[model samples]
Each structure stands twice: as structure tokens, then as C-alpha cells.
Target: MIYLDHAASTPIVESALNIYIKSLREDFANPSAAHKLGKSSMKKVERARQLILKSLKGSKKDQLIFLSSATEANNLAIKGIKLLPSDRVHYSVGDHPSTSEPVKSLNSQLVEIPLLEGGVIDEAKFLESLDKDSKLVVLSHVNNQSGNHYDILSLGKKVKDKFPNIHIHVDGVQGLTKVETNLSSLIDSYTISGHKIGAPKGVGALFIKDGVEVETQLHGGGHEFGIRSSTVNTPLILSLCEAITAGLEDVITNNKKVKRINSLMREELEAADLGITFPFSLDDTSPYILSFLLPSISSDIVLRHLEMKDIYVASSSACSSKAKGFNAGFDAMKIDQSKHKFVLRTSFSKDTTTEDIETFVKEITNIIKEIKRL
Candidate 1:
């Protein structure tokens, strides 16, 4: 089967899988235990934390808190922030629900960041939206649906330059190890997911910059530096660190390879004369995800047809794939409501080969033909 949903979740690489199995066998002791075996497991967990922080160019003073998933990490970063009713939180509706929903839940006055014609954040208007009361701004490094890569570093710098105290939180689930990320001082908190890169699910982390204190979301044994509390899963943490190391090792090379694959898919799909139009431009978006509009067909219908052929793609974020009605994210990206249901997203990994794209285009072409005939 051609699996082109890496943006949603990816199969764990062999190295990470091996490390997971090994850790499960050897590091079975509770990390919180006072026994020697537990101490050994705790040491491994600390090593994993340092390694992950270094991978993101994070300094030693920064805190890397492991959590259940990106959703939880995002929640901690958002709801944990101390906000007053008069404070304003700036966020785009285009962000993943993990980021957007939490911002909405906050008691602060919510301001929606507008998008330019090309799905870029409106810089001038964004600056105008901020005030002395603006406390936090939530953004996505790489958009899950449209693949638009926002220049968060520059944007964060802009935010800090104007409002020195406004915190910047990034949902980096789709960007970590997939893009060139440096957790500079400009960003206050960033989220990373294991499954997005080549590790198993049920593990993710939040990088809180030094001096940014987020209140504890989960209260238990005071784990994750007291930012998140739970029995730490050593095996999952080791495997996640291994996957992150492997993914970061070849970001430039993997990106180049995936760019070719993305180009091939776009070219072949365009060549099929299937009335497909790419929503995001290749020049600006991540090569890892390609979203297009399928003419005269709901992407959900096309998705089922593709699934019947043992191929997989996505019509929207996997979390909300089953949801119906108006999509706030699409609307924020300037996507016409009329064409929202027709948009199909096919994301790639380094393993996605040219043949996979060719077969996908061929099968999708046939599906469209078959549907038209019916």
C-alpha cells in the first residue's frame, strides 16, 4: 500500500523500533523508583532529554518536558500560561486544533491573526493586533493541511521586538526534525510529536525556553521537572530520542529527496488532466505535504476510493478527518468554503518513492474516470 500520510503519523523506523524493544526489555523499572534498576532507567531518561534538547539547538537551561502527545503538550503550553481577562491571545484559526482549541479555551481576549493572499500571516496586521495586553501568540511552524511553512523565527523576533514580554508558542509537531529548527530565545515553547517523525505514538515533548514557566497540567509524582506529572515511560522516551536523532541526522538530505518526490507527484497529477490544482505553492510550503483540490468530487469520496485500492491519503487533519461542516482552518487560509470538501492532502516521507507517486496518480486518475462514468 502507498502510505502518504506522514503528516498524520509515520511508521517507526527500524532503529527506533529496535531501541524501543530493547528498552522495554531492559529498562522495565519505574524511573521514579529508588532502586538501582530504577536509577539506571532514570539516567537513560535524562540522557534522552539532553539529546533531544541538543537536537533542537536548545540550551541546557531550557526545559524539555515529555508528555503523552502533541495535544497534551500544546494544552500545557497554552492553559498553563498565567493570563488575565484583560490579556489578549493572538492565534490563527489555521493552526491545528491542538493549538487553536487550547487558545480558545483561555480566558484572555482572543484575536485572530489574518492571512495574506498566499496563505501567509499578515505581518502588518499581526503587528497591529498586538497590544500591551497581548500576552501570548500561538502559531504552527508547518501547517498540517496546507503545508505552508511560516517563518516563525522572523515572526517571533518581530513579536519580541515590538512586545518584549509577549510569549511565542509554536506547535512544531509537523516541523520538528522535518525542518531546520533552532529553539532560539525568541520562542517560548515548542511542541514535538514522536509519531510525526519515525517513532511510535504515545510520546511527545514540549520545549519551554529558559525563564518561561508554565504551570503544571498533570499533578502526580512531580515528573517532567514538575511541568507535567506522570510515570515516565522510559522505553517510549528512548525510542523517541532515537527517532529524533535519526530524523535530524538527514534533514537536509531527506528534504531534498522529498522535494523531488513532491515535485514528481505534482507534475504527474497535473499531467493526468484530472482537474487538480495545488493549494499551496511549492516555493513556500514544506515538500513533505502536498494538498490539492480535486475537481467536482468530495475528497472524502476520493479518499475511500483510494483506500479501496490499498492506497492512503487524507482529506484533512487526521484528528478532524471525520468532522463535517465549516472548517475554520481552511477559512483562515483564504480557501473558499465552496472548495473545502474537495481539498485532498497527500503527505510524504523520505521513504515515499517516485513509483509511489506515479501509482497514486494513476489510481486516482482511474478513480476519477470511473466515478465520472457512473
Candidate 2:
């Protein structure tokens, strides 16, 4: 079966899988315990943390804490911060639910930055809305639905220049390893997921700048440097580190390969003239994700057709796929509501091949034709 939903999760790398199994089998000691086995486990956990920092190019001064998922990291970034009732938290209009939901649950004035027609963040509008009261802003480096990429580096610089005190947070889940980004200055908090890059689920990391203070929401024995409080998943963390490090091995080449598949998909789909509307130009997107808009076809129907043929894809954010409603990115971009249920999101991984793209395009073409006749 051809699985084109890497945005949801990826297969564990062979090397990382080996380490995971071995760690689960032999290294079952709790890192928090004081015995010799505990000390050894703690040492391994710290080593894994160091590898993660190095892999992401984060500084030693930065605090890297593991969380159950990116959702918790995002909640900690926005909800953990000390906020006044008058303070405002802003999030990009195209943010993932994980990044946007936490802010919504807060008492602070929730501001949503608008998106341009093609799903690009309205930078000018965002700047106009920015003021001294906007204490924090959450922006995703790469959009999950449309595959639209953002120039966070430049935007972060602009935000810092205008409001030196405002905190800038990033959701880098979709961009990690697949896309290269410099996480130096101008970023206060960044969230990344292990599952998105071939590590097992239930392991995510948050990078908070040295001086930034975010209170812990999960009260427990006080783990993750007190940012997230819980027992450490040492084996999974080690496995995540290995996957992240290995995923970076041929990034430049991998990116090119994925982008080629994306381009090929876009080209043939458009050439088919089957009313497939690409929200943005192919070049404007990351190679990892592609959202196809079939205004005249039902995405659910199309999905079933592909499934019967042993191909898998997604209709919306994998995290919120069960919820039936308007998608934020599509809504923000003013896509026709009639076309809402027909949008299909397909994400490719470094392992996706040219033949995979060819088969996908061919099957989609057939599905559209078959559905119309029915």
C-alpha cells in the first residue's frame, strides 16, 4: 500500500527501532531513582537530550524539555506563561489546533492574525494588530494543511524590532528535519514532535529560551526541568534523538526528492484539468505537504476510492480529522464553503519516490472520473 500521510506519522528508522527495542528490554530502570541502574538511565537520558539540542542547532543555554506531545508543549508555551487579563495572545490564522487551542482557553484577549488569499500570513495586518499589549505570538514555521511555508526568520526579526518585549513562539512540528531552519535568536519558544520525524508517538520536545519563564501546568514530581512534570520516557526520548539525528543525514538530498514528488503531483493534477484547485503555487509550499481542492468532488468519496485501491491519504489535519467542520486554513483563505468537504491533504516523506507520485496522480485521475459517472 502507498501511504502518503507522513504528516500524521512515519515509520521508525531501522537504527532508531533497534535502540528502542533494546532500551525497552534492558533499560527499564527509572531515571529518577537513586540506584546505579537509575544513575545510568539518567545519564543516557541526558545524553539523548544533548543529541536533540545538537540536532536542532539549539544552544546549550536553551532549555529542552520533553513532553507527551506537541499539544502539551504549546499549552505550556501559551498557558504556562504568566498572563494578565488585559494582555493579549496572538496566533497565526493558519495555526494547528495544538497551537491555537491553548490560547483560546486562556482569559487573555485572543487575537488571530489573518491570512492572505493564498494562505500566507498577512504580515502587514499582523503588524498593525501588534501593540504593547500583545505579549506573545504563536506562528507555525510550516502550515499543516496547505503546505504553505512561512519566512519566520524575517517575521521574527520584524516582531522583535518593533516590540522588543513581545515573546515569539513557533510550532515547528511539520518543518523539523524535512525543512532546514535556523533557530537562533528572535524565537522564545519552539515546539517539535518526534512522531512527525520517524520517532514513536507520545514524545515531543519544547525549546524555551534561557531567560524565558513558563510555569508548569502539569504538577507532579517536577520533571522536564519543571517545565513539564511527569516521569521521563527515557527509552522514547533516546529513540527520538536517534531518529532526529538520522533524519538529518541526507536532508538536502531528501528535500529535493520530496519536492520533486510534490511538483510532479501538482503538474499532472493540473494537467488533468479535473477542477483541482491548488490553494497556492507549488513553489510557495514545502515539499512535505500538498492540499488539493476538488470543488466538484467529495473528498470522503475520493478517499474511499483510493482506500479500496490500497492507497492512503488524509482529508484534513490528522489530529482533528474526526471533527467535521470548516478547516481553519481554508476558512481563513476564503475558500468556497461548498468546496470545503472536497479538500484532500497528502504529505510526502523523504522516502516517497517518483513512482509513488505517478501512481497517486494516476489513481486520483481515475477516481474523479469514476465518481462523476456514478
TM-score of each: 0.98, 0.97
Lowest-sum lDDT 10-residue window in model 2: 320-329
**Tens digits of lDDT, candidate 1, 124-168:** 999998999999999999999889998899999899999999989
- Model 1: weakest 10-residue lDDT segment is 322-331
| Candidates' C-alpha lDDT | 0.92, 0.85
At residue 327, give the lDDT of candidate 1: 77
Q: What are the candidates' C-alpha RMSDs?
A: 0.9, 1.2
How much is the lDDT of residue 46 in candidate 2? Answer: 90
Candidate 1 ranges with C-alpha deviation above 4 Å: none
